[model samples]
Target: MLAVPLLGLINQYLGFLAMIAAIVLVWKDSPWQKGAKVAATIAAMALLGAVLPDPPEEGAAGVARKDRKAAAARTLTSPSPSAAQDDPSPTTEPRPEAADYRGMRLDEARDKAEAAGFGTSDHNASDDDKNIWMRSNWTVCFQKSSWTGSETKTIDFGAVQTGAPCPSTDGGAIPWPTMPELTWKTWKTARNEVVALGVVPTEHLRADTAYLNDTLPDEGKYDNWRVCATDPLEGADVTINTWVTLELTHPDNGCPDPSQSKEDRVDLPDRDDDGDPDYHDPFPGDRNRNSVFPNGLPDSSGNSSGGDGSDGDSWNCPRTRWC
Candidate 1:
């Protein structure tokens, strides 16, 4: 009785206290304690071999801890929904292609070329002397590049012809005042080219002189007739609606004998009497020749073609047509 009283009162008995605790727990005789108390009690019971306390089963608490860890990992690695939506998608620009403008009217060709992202440059045109016939009656005969090629700066036009594809060439052609390169072209070809560029050509038949490239052929048989010279000359800028004389003769077919007087042959009028023609002479109608050259002579030789019989070389004046 004394032992029981002592044990119950003091609560210091050490004989398998786990059994007593478990019993106390089962009976609900002990007051409610902290979780540490439950844990300690479980360990004590395990030591004493009183049906070792089972480990905690994977329930909501364990599952919840695992879920929290997985969420943290995902936050560190994956992109957010808002960020993905804010990004923009990539795109590309379209390329331009070439278009064919051959056989079309000048105005129509220009418009079409512009629509296709290309520009037009008139290879041979007299913009200052633009005429009705040139604008409305001409068609593109040749081009620098094929219609199907890539886009470029200028589309060159070789020749203009008026026929089925184009309107009438009547009322004459344009009279542009720009200089054109007209070398080695026949008389008909040269006239068409220069007139197309806005200048009218005045033809001079050289009956006395022999001509090369068969100048002055009759009509459509112009294959043998070629141009030898031009008045404003081949490369001089002239006024629109002005005259540009072309010197034409057949050098191969018929040429006058050189032994005959060259002085008698039709020469351009030179009032200054210098060797150069009046049209080309810088200082015309000056007798002394001192106005053009330092001493009115081409060189120090002082060679002037005067028949006074001085027995010295004649003076060739720099800017005189003929003396």
Candidate 2:
């Protein structure tokens, strides 16, 4: 009586017609014959119905609608490239090509220096280390603004102790000292003196001091020796700020007066010598001593002010020591 086998034997349209015929035949025949015929017809119809392919259910209808909608959406949407072109708001602007500074990072202001054709040197090797020399004798100091951007700042190159051989790596290496060596006394006393002289502002002097203290010598043998300059000596009385001398030396070497004379080398104090302290002018030219030599101590020159003097008035103390 199952419809499945009968449906398979008959075509789908014929199966439908046979089911209707069986219903009608059951209604018209005599009781016994009718019952027999009806039963047989019903069995055939059931078999056909079972074997026929099922009509789509509600779930299937929903699936078909979703597929059609997805296709329509694809057709309605513009091509990716064309959509991007048509958009008025740009994702990014056309920026000026970033300049290269010989592996040095670039900043906006320092870009000018790179355009002027100057090379930069890396002075930072460690995270805790400070790179004071980056401001020395270079046209510009650049800082990485973001992962991809840079900005330029002006550096006081004239303050750099040029000609001083870079610090040695190993111990027992003879320290080939630089000229116009800055004693510990000079470094300690000079920062305030420069501000008093009106050459740099209090903030700038503090920044300079912080820079010296933070940046350690490559050898690490001398903790106190730092970058110092003699050119445009802190309190020199010159029409042009020449006669500048910049150097690196130990705090002991910076003492105004060593207990032993230059002839007999004396062991300078690491800390401030409380007794019989050697008093020396932090500034060069012995301005405190009244020793006036015509080209002032052999380091005198016309262009001694290392930085552009145009903005000397604005040289105030820096807000922060680090960039």
TM-score of 1: 0.25
Please identify model 2 stretches exceeding 4 Å from their true place.
1-14, 17-323
What is the per-residue lDDT of model 2 for residues 225-286, given as tens digits with 9 covering 90 to 100? 54434544444442212232333455533422334333343332313222211322223322
On the 0 to 100 scale, the lDDT of residue 243 in model 2 is 30
The list of candidate 1 runs beyond 4 A from truth reads: 1-98, 107-229, 237-243, 247-323
Q: Give lDDT for model 1.
A: 0.49
lDDT of 1 by residue, 1-323 (tens): 12222333344344355356565664465554666557655655554443333457779778988899999999978878887678756666554444666677766776776666666654433222444356455566445543334534455543353332221332224433565665446666767776666334344221211232222334555544545545565567565334666545442333333344434444445676654444435556653443345234443465543323232244443374343
TM-score for each model: 0.25, 0.22
lDDT of 2 at 63: 99
